[model samples]
Target: FYIHYIASTLKILHEEGYIYRDLKALRASCAQPVYFSPFVKASNVLLVEGRPVLIDFGMCKNISKTGRTYSVCGTYHAMAPEVRALSGLDHDTRAATTSGYGYPVDFWGLGILLVELLTGKPPFGYRNGDIGDLFELSRGSPSTIHWAAGFEPSRDLRDLVESLLQPDPSKRLADWNATLNHPYFAGITDDMLPPEWDSDLGTEL
Candidate 1:
């Protein structure tokens, strides 16, 4: 459902530009997602009759022409490493810097979402409420994200989260097909998503 919403938004953008010639070809091509929704956290998503609906397009951007945006927007804890670097900069400095980000930023946010769901908090921050310390974590190098002590998820889950969270955009799991086939979601299909979670399993906690 999430993919469907994003894909539809991008399709609408293509239509508006009058550049959409062959819809079939456009859908078949292995295109990176063009709609960049920097803010993809839980609060921005709503559950509507068992469907996951996204809201808050105020920071949403379509990277159709230039293929990247240098604008720094989104919550720091859920923001991508690349975007996070320029978050607090002035508009002139933001444009001066060539470190623009594309669709891969969403994947980083997805990884942060997974970590937040599993552990109840984002993994990096400047001890307590300091945003500066959080910036330091993703500043100069590839950020190192680790599971908090004593919370050990299975190996497959760990691997998926790590791949999605890779600080390097090139190395991150940004492919839609690859992510759907990952071991962590092996048995799940589009028709078998969040709605199925309502089934009652025996409780142990």
Candidate 2:
């Protein structure tokens, strides 16, 4: 249920030409799978009426017109490899070059969140809770899941996670439309989605 909600949220954001750089457990608010949240880490998520909702927008980025951004921001463990790669360069270098990222970064973060939801830990080992270690791990290689005893996930689900976590953003799932069409969401259709899920918020940002 949370997967569907998150996918829908991503769909909405994509239609609006924005990228939600932050995706993590604390960034979601849910009551039996009604999810919403905004920007950054755990502290930004809040509960409303027993449902998790994203409450912070401080780090949200509007990329509708340009379809990309180069800001090296977002939590370490949840960042896409390209986003983490930017950390080694100075801001001036980033601004002077065409190197940056786009919506795929959010999908990478969502992949991390999905792993955490299933296994109670990020796909990459937490690296003793060190931010630098986490970034290094994220930038190194794609993660392989090792489920706890008797907690194995379905093959389709695992495939979905792996696809989203692809190190190459270009090769990652191509936005929410492609995501919702995956086998993991086999039976879900546009008719079942909420009205807001289809509304185009436009490229005003």
Candidate 3:
């Protein structure tokens, strides 16, 4: 259910030429943030009708027309390597030094979500909310994903997470079609997805 819900959301956003910069767990009722410090994380997720639904669109941006955006914004732990790179800049310098990012950042967040869901924590454990450590850990090699003792995920699941978590956005699983075709989703079918899911996104894997 979580997988389908996330896929459906991404499909819609991609079709509309947008990227859900903040893909962490969100409360269905909290679509908009009232305070200035807005960030997405597992703590924000809320269960609606027993299904996971993302909310808090405060950080979302329309990338359809531009294809990319430079402003870096998102939770420290869930951010992709490219977005994390922006941490090196101060607020004033970010505008000049940031190279911008595309939709693949959300895929990296998805990989973090998968790891958290399976092992009860993100692949690279958070360190006191330090952006430097988070950035370094996120950029670590794929072999850095540590599985908890007694919890061995299947090879397909591991592969999917690794692919999505690729440090380089160019190599990450940024397409919905390619992502859905991964072996981890082998048994999923159209009937099991939400009506909003775009079946034409790509041929089934």
Candidate 4:
């Protein structure tokens, strides 16, 4: 139920030239997320009418030609591999896969959420009680996904989740049209739009 909402949330962030970089279910020690540390990256959100709305943006940055940002930002489990590889502001993806980094990292988080929703816990158990190696392994291996105790995911949902978990940014789910056409999004069609908007808004809101 929540996975669909998360996927839609991610789609909007991407189209808006913003990437979540981190998405989580934790409430910060402060009333609001601290931002850019264990505080909050982009994952902080609330459910409204069965949809996810991004609630933290301190770590947010405009998409740039460099197509990357340099910071040790984001929860460990939700961190993108590219971010894990960065040393600092000099963080460079030129030598990486060249598929463009940053935002895809957040999609990785979304994948984690899908597993969690179905399994009653994260794909990998969090012994540390936080989002650590979950993101680390997610960036390196999507096969680590574990099915929930009694539930079996449809092959189609499993495939979509696997594609989102891809380690290579270039190979990750990169096409909006393709994603919309995927079986996971099948029942929901282009005609499903808000009363005041057209489906063509393309994240303009």
Candidate maximizing TM-score: 3
Off by over 4 Å in 1: 1-46, 88-98, 126-133, 139-143, 146-150, 193-205
Model 2, 76-175: lDDT tens digits are 6676777776776322222222378888888888788877776666776554554444444444345544454566878898889888987767678766
Tens-place lDDT per residue, model 1, 1-205, is 3443333443454334312111111121211221223332333333443444334445667667776777777765666666755654322222123377777776666666556545545556423464553545454333456566677979987888778777667678876566656787765554533433332333331
Residue-pair clashes per candidate: 0, 6, 4, 4
lDDT of 4 by residue, 79-154 (tens): 5556655633223434344333666777667766666545556665563663343444434555666676677889
**Clash pairs for candidate 2:** 29-52, 29-53, 30-52, 36-54, 37-54, 38-54
Q: Lowest-scoring 10 consecutive residues by lDDT in candidate 4?
A: 27-36
Off by over 4 Å in 4: 26-46, 87-100, 127-140, 189-205
On a 0 to 100 scale, what is the lDDT of residue 6 in model 4?
53
lDDT scores of the candidates, listed in order? 0.52, 0.65, 0.66, 0.57
Off by over 4 Å in 3: 26-43, 89-98, 129-133, 137-140, 193-205
Task: Summarize candidate 3's per-residue lDDT along 35-130 as a digit string, tens digits.
Answer: 212233424643333355667778888987889898878876677777766766322332222577888888888888777666666676765644
Q: By TM-score, highest first, what's the ranking?
A: 3, 2, 4, 1
Worst lDDT run of 10 residues, candidate 2, spans 89-98
